[model samples]
Target: MNRPTTLALTFLTLTLAACGRPASTPAVSTDDTSSGSVADAGGHGAGGNGAAGHGDHALAAPGPDRSRLPSRAVLGPATVAPGLRVQTLPANVQPNLLALKVLILSSGPSDYGIGTARALLDQSGIPYDVLDASRTPLDTAALIAPDGSGRYQGVILTDSALIMDAGNGTYPSALDSAEWDTLFEYERTFRVRQLALYGAPGSVPEDYGLRYVAGAETATTSLRLNAAGQAVFSDLKGAAIPVTYSYTYPSALQSVPGVSTQVLATDPSGRVLAATSTSADGRERLILTSAQNPYLTHSQLLGRGLAQWLTRGVHLGEHRRFLQVDIDDVFLEGDHLTSALTLTAPFRLSGSDLLNVRTQQDRLRSNYPAAPNFRYALMFNGGGANTAVPTLCTNSPWLTRDLLSSVARCLNTQFDWVNHTLDHQRMDVMPLSTATTQIQQNLSVGTKLGLNMSRASLVTGEHSGLGFMDPTDDGTRNDDGTAGPKQDLGLGRSNPNLLSAAVSSGVTYLASDHSVASQWDAQCPTCGVPHPLNPGVFLVPRWPNSVAYHVTTPDEATAFYNSLYGPGGLFPYWDRNLTYAEFLDRESDQALTHILNGTPFPHFMHQPNLRQYAGGKSLATDWVQAALVKYSTYSKLPLNTLRWDDLGAQVRRHTAEVKASAAGTLSGTWNRSAGTVRLTSSAGTVPVTLSGASSGTLYGTDRAARYDLSGSLDVPVTPR
Candidate 1:
């Protein structure tokens, strides 16, 4: 791939009004709550910064025809060479233009722009349009008067030439002398929100009140959040984040005579690292530090927060966060029955063991209300050896088949169970036929054992860690008669056969992780544009730190769990070692971060956690109970413990809602009088989460109901 010419464009001179009268150095407040005040501008009955004419009433319908625009063109096949294959985005679904729309102006495929922005927007289910300036420089006239009127509510500029890509080496003179004069006038007169990265002086209208000033070449600098930034970025409310900056440009925004300005972050030397300014006409502009790339977690967080701020946090839905818990490797496996300092033979699962796990689950229930404490999701894999003929072991009065059936009966309840494949074989390494055996045999074994296997969501053994599909051999063999020329399948690149097999077998959910591959993969956590390959199937990445600890003794389990703490542990800042009491604190602190951020909490563990430890003590039970306490304590909102299958289904519906919202097929009106928010969509189902309502069902374009917050009734509307 070709590299971008520059990190970002220096500037794109625009002439809204001549250099504004110099204003005083605005008092920079250090309180994070300042951004909250700005957010209140979107509250009931405010039209300045809020979408024009949208007051407290939820339906801020722009006075325009509701006809859907032409869908985006479908991308051709995998024509790009191996590696760095960009998946073609699905054609844009025609949507209601009344929903807020954003346009991304870039300098072509090589421009390292909007990758992070797109990830953030897609994650929130917001729709945006892309304008490749390299193919065709921005049409300044149509930008301001597309169809003879302002067509976009917001704009993001990553390249300076987007305003005026004058082909010759000649530079545009003053702002008034440039062709962007009309662009600036429309921004001021119509109040279009914008987020610009690394632009030159006069690149944006002067009245907008933010200019990029290149910093003195220096080493990486740590950024301290000012009060305004605290309000915008939840993670930085009480913390300082560092972004390595050497050749990057820092920003300097001053409050114009009539505009309101807030400095969000400052370098050690107090140079503006980030800032936001709201114009007198309610046009808001947010500027951030220009650096190498914005794909890092910290960068993604900042960019995601910026998108939320730009949209006033209402494009997707009310700004609410959620948590989900998942448990993997659930099966009737052999375990040692110890007594009087002696070990017995292997056994499936004793009645005492089932009772112990149930007791632990009861402990989890004690922490929350009755219903929310039910069984979480379980990923099951029927042992291959025992599926055909039960293995004999002793658990006092329980052995092989009897013990397995008893355990299965204990777990038969309202729970979410997933197929983990037969004998835990990696499905990706197998062909379609082999993959079918692995999946079907497991379900078959589950049926014989009376285990709940109705759900067909496949977690895949080791999450397909064993490569996605066998390598195409060049008909060559190694010295040991092994095949040569093994190829690894990339998750982001095309894998049509795998997709075909999954859909053919009735699998609706697949596994993905939040790492590099996902950044571009069709089903990814950090993907630039997350989309499901199959219509009903959705790839849900496991929570980043979901751990699978292996240990045979109490001391080993303790040491293993503690090992995940400091240094290479999930949370390095937590230095406390694993003690019965101290482990709770350390794990709670770690889990608290996910909860406080409103991120989904899918804590994963294996089936062994339910078995007995030293002295017949159930360590898994204790560990799970402790985790439940911590997760429930800091999760902020009311707890809703869903099975993985239910959660995955909700996520699938939510993803559809997000895609349709971006396509402009969804819209809603907030009725303050009835204290309910109502939404309408072109599709039959729209999965929605009302602000404070714990549970309620919303479906289709005409469904209406008063959103109730007095009870826990805010569950998502599942499609019939």
Candidate 2:
């Protein structure tokens, strides 16, 4: 294929922009061109600079005084019923094997740390049983099996001491002296590690070799990870992580014989925020003095490490950050908004625009090490491509379509390609023959263009044909000449002809809109919803963003955004019209939540969003890059990108595992000495993730492997 000089010039411009060159002026007039730097976007740099050291003397300089700030709710005094005393257990009670499960001890359901602890375990897919100390009585049976095998490998306490308010002006220990001794005895016998989600330093129920130095400090505090913390949380790259909206207790380590205290995290004053203590009897415990919730940045950053430490780097389920963007209507023309805020039809991406996108993709991967595997998935319409034109670049100005087709063919392997039908027609009411042709003809066209496309995946136009629209249309259309007010009629009303056509065309994964309630699998939030009409095809939901399909420039996007969300507009949520930068900030924040939560849903945008607005940036890439930059501030975990087929299979496996877990049919045991994990399921195949094991992806310092088990299976592992 002949290389166009325009393509080469566009690449040069993009390369210059990527290398910190000054951005070119926008082709269209914009209301605001002040795209703020990533550092100034949010509180991302709150802990960028802080003292990094080890040992008790590793103190940070005192931060700004916030003594006048109101203190957060503090733990009431810990007291047991009068005359309660510790009880001793038999020395011969020892366990040889333990199950790879966790036991969470919480004061009650209202305990804040309960949610925080559960979030960590849930996201990592680790199995855990919770017992309310205030309600449930602890016994040796709960700790050990009949065969002398321990039931849990680790224990998580809502706080250092399970103290509860007795509603009579006294805060009492939910687990009295005897109960506490029972738990400690189990830990001493089984050698299982324990983690306290929150703690107040003192010798109330137990001493962690810490003395309280200060009460709750409610402010954003920068915490530096000490040597012990770095070893436990190996993924953290020795940077200070900000802890916000937390009730913190800064403490000092006290000298205790036969007990070694290692400070994990410390505040500016060198006071402890998190620490680990090992007793003479080999019982180990990790305690964090700060309160945590799932939404906090500190919690998200520390959760995986905490879970790994709790389970000794062996657990069920997997935690992976996924971010995939699917651009729909790739070869087709979409509507565009003019500088005058008028909507116009027939706006297609030029060959130069494609080259700029390719350059930006490479730049993003190079710039953000965490997102090195990122690539865009293009959903294309075959009817819009001009295959009849010569593959070589031509001088004819009217052959823009030919130029686009030629460029796409040349760079076909750079991106993932998916079928978006032939004419981009809605299949809600299409006949079987028409639907089949729309599905198969597109595959043929993709094959003809040498595109690396898959027949197992398909993205129907507007995510139609999956039965989520108004049943009674009244034969009316909207201003855009499309059906109005689509209501979710549920998957039962899905078009049979379309389903059959897709099945015959070998389509296994069908794209659906996540905004539609009926399109997603409610049982397993991260799994693909199996179509009720056709079991062969699964509905893989795609997240939608704020970028409109019709806007090609920032000015147009800003104008359209203001009309819907600005003051005196349709939604009127914002006080004033947001600039393009502010708009991106809000949009990226939503995406960041999904990225942090390990959600694998791919976000969908339109072809117009691929336009290189300015500075070699497009609306689609900007949103993604913004989220990635923010994520980099807190985590170093790689963001996973999967093809459509692989994503579908992952969803299916995850669904099976969830079902098996819920049914209590999945179980596993880890033999420490043998360095092997044996997993078994009474029912169908279930996916089990084991850290420090052989096989699967390498996450952080441990290699987490997933095993699909139907019967019993043994996997060799290196215990951490």
Candidate 3:
């Protein structure tokens, strides 16, 4: 009685096959102890020379003007300690863009002449980072520190940003006389220099790092680095460009509906006081908003250009989030070695590798910026007719230890203990005791290794392959051996039975054993196939179309998803891929497109260490990044929430809105608008929207169907 249907779909302990189960399935260097040069960021040439024009006599040789002569060039003068030490820029840049390396003798919160230069760099999108002089103490003692990441394209000031006072033991906001002389010495070297006359003329010294704020008549008379890494006269003016606001509208998300947006000004008649608008892409936008927008609560305003604009000269488009994920599972000594689905995460085996566990953790961290969704699940084997636990199952314990600790260090990615099974025993052979033992050992090891095994959402154990199925975990081979409980894709009565088994044994997310696209079921499967690994998506079950490994192929993977998610079928069915890598990429790409398209992202989990998804760097890390990009784009939600329940709800909401009409129709509403179409009916109202439906309207009686639906639809008003 393999009755597989949408109604049978339920959450249970699931397992994915390795390839298809049982059945199938920083550069940096520098002894200088200073940050990299500004030229490294490329803006060197006012044109793009890529490097600072090499230092030459042209820069060192000052004009014949007697007054402009160096004020006695000195380095770490014994009489006066803590002075400036100048160094050549590490790299060169375009001549147009003035670049140099200025060294400060000490640390200061304010500029010795650095702030002005920083402002210019930020405005130009030139890369830069600040290094504490303390990190490279040697450079500081010598009045130079170029060992940091910033390459020498621009000004490098040593201990210049630091302003310290010895007499009062507290450096004031203003610089001391000695500091002025140091910047003055570099004034001649600056490709562009500024000169300011003091009230006392020659008596006054150079004061660098200070710039004209709101209202200033002339540059600081003492010394200062102008916008161009040059010393300028008090009357010298640097370029200042008003900031330009820019936003992106992706072509992918231009059609979803139901999103209503508007632009509003604070004072009604006020000129663009503030405004919120929506574009084809799903992103929501608000401009000129006050720092006090309550809706931007809980630090929402912290990013999204507000804080960045305040601190950095430019605003962020959208920041990407990164995370590392490792597969983990505790195991006992009785789990099977070659069973259809092996319980690896929480393996009840005799031999397991502890270091392998740490390596899994390392893999996750490597994809840090990519924000990989790391996870661990137990792999379980299903018994079709075998009896007695396998002897080889005992070795699993030693093999599982390594993965356990790897997952314990991080919580960003999911780490769910799955149910592999006890003694690697076949369900048909052993009694309920087998499932119990597997769960116990799996949970026990997780506890021992410090994993949060208390609760998780994926239950990948025995016969629990990747996809949902029925008869897969029914009563098993009965005493008669006539016909085991009905079986199909694990969605039959077997599923509920499996759930009861999971709850009784403490397991969820049942992995469908042998769930991959097999040669037998690869033909346009109702549940989608990675199991019984096959060739094409449309071949019949009886055909000889074999697996293309297809995942490695671009086209095959696409067909698999379309078949399952296509209209009028397979709604909200949980499915798994043949390998960890395949699952990672397919799931992430799917979720991201859905999000970018403004559609709801589907909830899916990958079993790390499952040979399939965690194979190579490109496959593992790339897929994880795809997932992170999708998650980050949402901007307000976490990755975990994209689970069964949330996805179920979204499926329904979007389907109705995408298929039905808008609201206020009977209320004599004129053109409601695009994306969000509103309609009015005697019963109630129905509003429809999707990720990219620019236009379309329809009304009808609601019908229960797959894919999340709120139930019922609205009647169309022929413009009554």
Candidate number of the best lDDT: 2
TM-scores for all predictions: 0.55, 0.81, 0.28
RMSD of candidates 1 onward, in order: 17.4, 11.7, 27.8
| Best prediction by TM-score | 2
Rank all candidate structures by their lDDT, best first, as comma-separated numbers: 2, 1, 3
Candidate 3 runs further than 4 Å off: 1-430, 454-490, 495-497, 505-619, 626-720
Tens-place lDDT per residue, model 3, 175-219, is 333443433333322222221100111111211212112222111
Q: After superposition, how far is residue 185 of candidate 3 from its true place, in Å?
A: 77
lDDT of 2 by residue, 627-665 (tens): 887778667778888877777777777766756775679
lDDT of 1 by residue, 1-720 (tens): 110011000110011011111111111112111110110111111111111110000111111110110011011111111222222211331111222456676545434444544544554445667776446533444453323334454667653333322334332221222323444444555455677653332333344455545433233566677777867764333445545421234556655677777888877778776777776666678765543233222343365466656654434343223445455555534223232212234333344565555555665667654224556566666762244334332243334445544455446563466777665544333466656776777777667655665464777654553232235422121101112211234554434445566667777766643221331233323222233454555676554321222233455444544443335543232445556566544444344433333334354545545566544355555545555565443222344555666666655555555555555556443222343334566555555433223243222111112321221222222110
TM-score of 3: 0.28
The list of candidate 2 runs beyond 4 A from truth reads 1-74, 78-94, 162-174, 211-216, 256-258, 279-281, 338-342, 392-401, 427-431, 474-484, 521-523, 555-579, 582-586, 684-687, 694-697
Query: How much lDDT does candidate 2 score?
Result: 0.70
lDDT of 2 at 57: 7
Better of 1 and 3 by lDDT: 1
